[model samples]
Target: MPPKPGVIPLGPLRLGDIFNGAFATVGRHAKQLFGVGAAVYGGALAVVAATIAIAYAATADHLDRIFALSGDEDPRSEDWVPLLVAFCAIVLVCLVAAAISTAMMYAAVPVVLQEAVLGRPTTFSAVWQRAWTRVPAVIGTVFLTWVIAMVPILLAWAGVVALVIGVVSMDGGDGVSVTLVVIGILGALATAPLAVWLWVKFSLAPSAVVFENQGPVAALRRSSLLVRGDWWRIFGISLLAGAVAGTASYLIQLPFSFIGMFSGALGSANLSDDPNPTSVIVAMSGYALAMVIGQLVSQLIVATFPPLVTGLLYVDRRIRTEDLGPVLAEAAAVPPQYTG
Candidate 1:
């Protein structure tokens, strides 16, 4: 609280104030945030790029062989194995990076912001200590939210499948596929509201898990309690923050896109210069590095905003619910109570 001026005010924040404070929080703590982010996200992205590079390196020759086959010749099963292996490796890398980065983005960023809010000195070690311990619960919260958000799509898929089955069983003729299309469209239309409702209702769960140290289920309940009667405001702020974050991320990432395009153009031009594999590898590596840089910068900005704003919203809810600002202001000066 000693450095309290730029810290969010310890009272109910309007949409305007919340956004203002959200930006302020990012600005005030950008150094620590980005430092922590670099380690967590940078490694994950490197894995992605490395996987892609490896796949390309591993399969390039096999792909060339498949393409070089004579007009009358077909590829053998062995010709497909390299492609298959590369595809599986890419998928595997993606899944692992996704799992690691989700917790780092949602759980880790909020933990850092909460420490700042509590007026504690934030170091990478301190932030990681808090967030790393809660990684499991944070990931569970993420998993639960995704499952909930995908309910509509899953339902539509099921409905489509069921409709097809019934149509086949009944020997329904030409119109069955048309009926499936209609049901799918209706299901999509109906899913929007349901997904938005669930999303807003549980949006604060990640913040609850970090700041309140609640488990996934209890964090869900905590968010529901805090979000009661303020659903619209939360939704509005979330939408606005999403727009701002998306725009900022796009702008930050725009140059990298240009770099990608330029590298690609450069690569395309160079491809005709030589039929040699070494030149091709060099060009491909350059393109891959460009993409990796773009993604890393994109992740930095993209990952910061949502959790920061959501954490502020959690603070706003607490101020309204229990007058939490004064206590948090004193957070660094006091020891935590553990009566529960």
Candidate 2:
């Protein structure tokens, strides 16, 4: 393909081109993307870090109750209040942060990519202004997707329940129950692939909403239309992108992984010697910080890369099926007609 004036080529893209384009998209728009990243993921990481610190503090506070158990007191039987508080804190933080990150990042990336394709530089403010228009559609699309993806699992679970109920009502013995368990296992296995296929079927939804200016319901239909005969192509590209991105993230996180490993080892070793709460807290702190850093980097990769690939897939599908390149080019070329 000849070089185009944009971050990505105007023609249909190869896998290498898609991945390279994702990198180029970020490289060309680092300030804007990173600013968006800082706004979306940075806040979440802060919440996680604060919540984890509180959780650790809770564990440290309850350690005395755990260690002070005498012959009469069983440590297992004791209710650890602080630790329970910590677990709840962590869960709450994760739930809130996950909801925010999932909704907004999906909205933001496609908006910027659309601008990139149009041969315009986008600012963080401009991206946010445009992206906000698609958030409701993005959220609805995501919810619908989750519901669709759950169909297989839900059907499998229903089968298991029906089998158990029928067997119990008929006074069937252990052998029948064991047979039902095997059936449930096979049902789950078969449905897992179906679930993944269904996901790929609707994976281009955000792009449809953003680039094609479709509503939530319309976006779902548009995504299905675009992916109609090309499910395998999208699936293969997605898998390859995942493999490359996952490997890069793992290598980038290796140093932090090593620090976490060493910290865990030190904490475990301390259990045999002094076994003090301070040593446990110190080790746990190191491990927690390392894990947080790793998570942030992983999230940044996810925010930057996967959407770019998905956006490219969306564009490639449109170019092939609908002759989208000329339409986009024509729109970019023609000035707005004014009668006033």
Candidate 3:
């Protein structure tokens, strides 16, 4: 039986449905969506790498001093100012990368969703052309989210530090460590609920930003509305998405990690119970390889999943609100324009 227009419930959704739908959508529109996603990921990564390289070049002296390299260091103690400026510069670059990626994903979602609903190829260029206009909205949403997310992260870090200090300052005698461990566990428990809430709230923010051309607060509000009365469903779906993506990422990066671990072990052997320059270089090389592998995995995972779910949700919302059957039919022949 065909589902009636505006009768399908989007909110208070089932976790299994969302997860299965996301996967099905990905399978259905794998080629074009994946192509665009990969392009976005590549572009964003290149920009981010360039930004980091610029930052490193700008503050090489400060970084060298921070590492305590024994050489003719800068005489000024205020080299930290350069480091701070470089950090900010890198952050700004990251923000720009995020906004660009989000915009591309926004464009990709409508195309993927349309294709999934009515099995066909979408014009990548047209989708991208429309997406360019929505860049301002995407940037605004990213900016707002960036500002809001920092608050909780900072608070969480501060709490962690306080917990560590509290544990260390306690008496070390006779099961005191156990007591402190319990307290630390309790603190983590306290933070877990906040983390979960934040996750649900912001999970759909990207969609809102992409679709609504909204500022951060408005985008968050829209997400909250969409997610209302269905937090567990969204949360469960999120966990499933994360698990699948994480497994895929781990599998992809496993070889790299193994190589890094092997090199690290070799480096440790070279230490001879005393670190030397060769050992340091070997260790740093392994560490750098691990980091590079991690970044690659992260990019691949991000490129793979977010668009799938966002596209599905956009369709789900349309099915719930508008008479999406005809729209989707038209979208089948002509790719749907991202209304947001």
How high is each candidate's TM-score? 0.89, 0.83, 0.64
Q: Which portions of model 3 show Cα errors greater than 4 Å?
A: 3-17, 51-88, 142-195, 198-202, 208-218, 261-294, 321-340
Shift of residue 234 alpha carbon in model 2, Å? 1.3
> In model 1, what lDDT does residue 151 have?
94
lDDT of each residue in 182-276, candidate 2, tens digit only: 88888988899988988999999988988877887788888999999999999999887777778878887888889888877776765646566
Model 2 regions more than 4 Å off: 1-3, 52-89, 165-171, 263-279, 331-340
lDDT of 1 by residue, 1-340 (tens): 2235336766777777777777777777787678778888887877887898788888888878886788999888887887998999899989978887778678777876765665555666766677778889988987898798779878887888888888888888758778787888888788878888888899999999988789999998898899999999899888888888788878877787778778877876867643555566676766667777877777777788877889899988998899886776666566432211
The total number of steric clashes, by the backbone 3 Å criterion, in model 1 comes to 0
Q: What is the C-alpha lDDT of each candidate?
A: 0.79, 0.79, 0.63
The candidate maximizing TM-score is 1
lDDT, candidate 3, 264-286, per-residue tens: 78766756654544347656677
